[model samples]
Target: MAQPRRRATPTKRDLLRADLRRSTPEELSHALQMLLDQSRLSRDERLHALASALVVEALAPYWVGDRTPNQAHDALCADDEELARVIEALAPMLLGHIEVREEARDAVATIEAMLGF
Candidate 1:
């Protein structure tokens, strides 16, 4: 009989969040510490939203392809204004296509409801 393949283990981030939901102090602290690493952002929600936006942006390369597409994101992070614009423009559309978590959905909404569009 053929057997099903085992799924990949959840990431540390996922484990951390799970621990948070369980009210485990160590896990909660780890999650907070992780967010603290990105303290430049005004809120964790904003960071969460940007993280969601980035996953959406990342998938663009598959559709954007190597057909003379912009290479800025590949070259350097935050050096691609056009990519940012395109990501912002296409975020809503991308949201429908992805199977993101509620947190990620909220993050996407955060980006959408920002000062601009």
Candidate 2:
């Protein structure tokens, strides 16, 4: 008898990360806006924190060199106010963290410049 093949299930974090990675700049911005808007109505502190963290992760690609800073800037030019607002809210938190990886510094710097901070 042939053995049955088991399908692997992705964990929530893995799924979220993949979705963020696949999103275009506009789609990613919209997703972050939704998460931020949802976080406001939810009273769960953990949920809010998770949403914030996910937003940060979603923004990481812009800073990670896989996506150029100019691409992010161009997306910003498309008038994504929610994306701008989310970036303004999250940039400080990301910059203040002590554990940010060295590779992410350039991306972070790009974000800072974009935000005029």
Candidate 3:
């Protein structure tokens, strides 16, 4: 006997996907161009962050556990060399998009200045 398959849970963008599908393909193409023009900067950042996160995940497949990534906030404390290389490679690529995040720290500064976080 075959059981009917259940529908998958919808992602946040699922409504947009559904709307696009209902639209004429030609209309959808036009809408895409308009949306891109309006939100190019946000789109660029999202793509870059997604790419960096995916690269890190792909590099450490065996590190799978039961947390929604950075959820535990402790994974960042682990010591590993390959992890170092992963971060180093991603730093320059991400600098332009995240200049504030890429700033260097000064250990000799006053407490408040040193805590520029």
Q: Top model by TM-score, which number?
A: 2
Give the local distance difference test score of model 1.
0.57
Model 3, position 2: C-alpha lDDT score:
95
Compared with the true structure, what per-residue lDDT tens digits does model 1 show for residues 1-117?
Answer: 999975444455665555456667776655655655545555644555666757555645543645333453444235555766656565565465354666788888899889566
lDDT of the candidates, in the order given? 0.57, 0.60, 0.56
Instruction: Between candidates 1 and 3, name the one with more favorable TM-score.
Output: 3
What TM-score fits each model? 0.21, 0.29, 0.27
Off by over 4 Å in 3: 1-41, 62-91, 102-117
User: Once all C-alphas are superposed, what RMSD does model 1 give against the true structure?
Assistant: 14.8
lDDT of 2 by residue, 17-77 (tens): 6477678988776565555454445444444466567665555545565667656645553
lDDT of 3 by residue, 1-117 (tens): 999975454443643554775699777655544544445457777567555775566446434677654432235435555665666566567766566544432333455576784
- Report the lDDT of model 1 for residue 55: 56
TM-score-based ranking: 2, 3, 1
In candidate 1, clashing pairs total 0
Whose TM-score is higher: candidate 1's or candidate 2's? 2
